[model samples]
Target: MTSNEHELEDERALCRYCKAPVPENEWFGLEVTRPVKMPDGSTSEVDVDFLDAVFCSQEHAALWLAAPIPPTVVPQVTVFPRWTRKLQRMIERGRP
Candidate 1:
């Protein structure tokens, strides 16, 4: 591949916690929720914007329940393929 030759966008998604790119079959998602006050004046859990966040495992999914909200992306860092965490992990693990 050449610098100008376009490649398919990387289809992989990373775990929200550990940031690992596990297989799709291994991907675990949990509902993003918030406490809602019902008409009866009792608090109840409701999905937040009907969104689901991904995790590599149940452990991470659980941890994410207490993790801080998503971090802001550094625009310059995201532009280069070399800086993506997924690529870095692949290099570290010696995977293609």
Candidate 2:
């Protein structure tokens, strides 16, 4: 067989979205952009790209694009102690 075919035979990268082995020919880089809303009601942009793109199938691409954000489990914030709040108030008053 050809060298390209040999390389494809050796390839085993899988698509994160679909869990299928990716082929050599369809490998490509994809740029993803997400829009953000500012406090002033204006829109901003954020973007990221896959370090390496390898697609097992077109369905893999679709699923990755539609994945939901993972949840974060941060501890809840509590009110500051009375003494700390008083110290903060004194500090703020001292500032001109």
**Which candidate number would show the highest lDDT if scored against the true structure?**
1
Runs in model 1 lying further than 4 Å from the true structure: 1-9, 35-50, 68-96
Candidate 1: tens digits of C-alpha lDDT, residues 1-96: 654432221456678888777566788888754554454656555423234678889899889878775633222423466557778898899998
Using all chains and alpha carbons, the TM-scores for the candidates as numbered come to: 0.43, 0.35
**lDDT (Cα, 0-100) at 37 in candidate 2:** 43
As a whole number from 0 to 100, the lDDT of residue 73 in candidate 1 is: 28
Positional deviation of residue 96's Cα in model 1 after best superposition, in angstroms = 58
Query: Residue 82 of model 1: what lDDT?
Result: 55
Could you tell me the TM-score of candidate 1?
0.43
Query: Candidate 2: where are CA atoms >4 Å away?
Result: 1-11, 33-53, 69-96
User: Candidate 2, after superposition: displacement of residue 79 in Å?
Assistant: 26
- Which residue pairs collide in model 1, if any? none
Displacement of the residue 37 alpha carbon in candidate 2, Å? 13
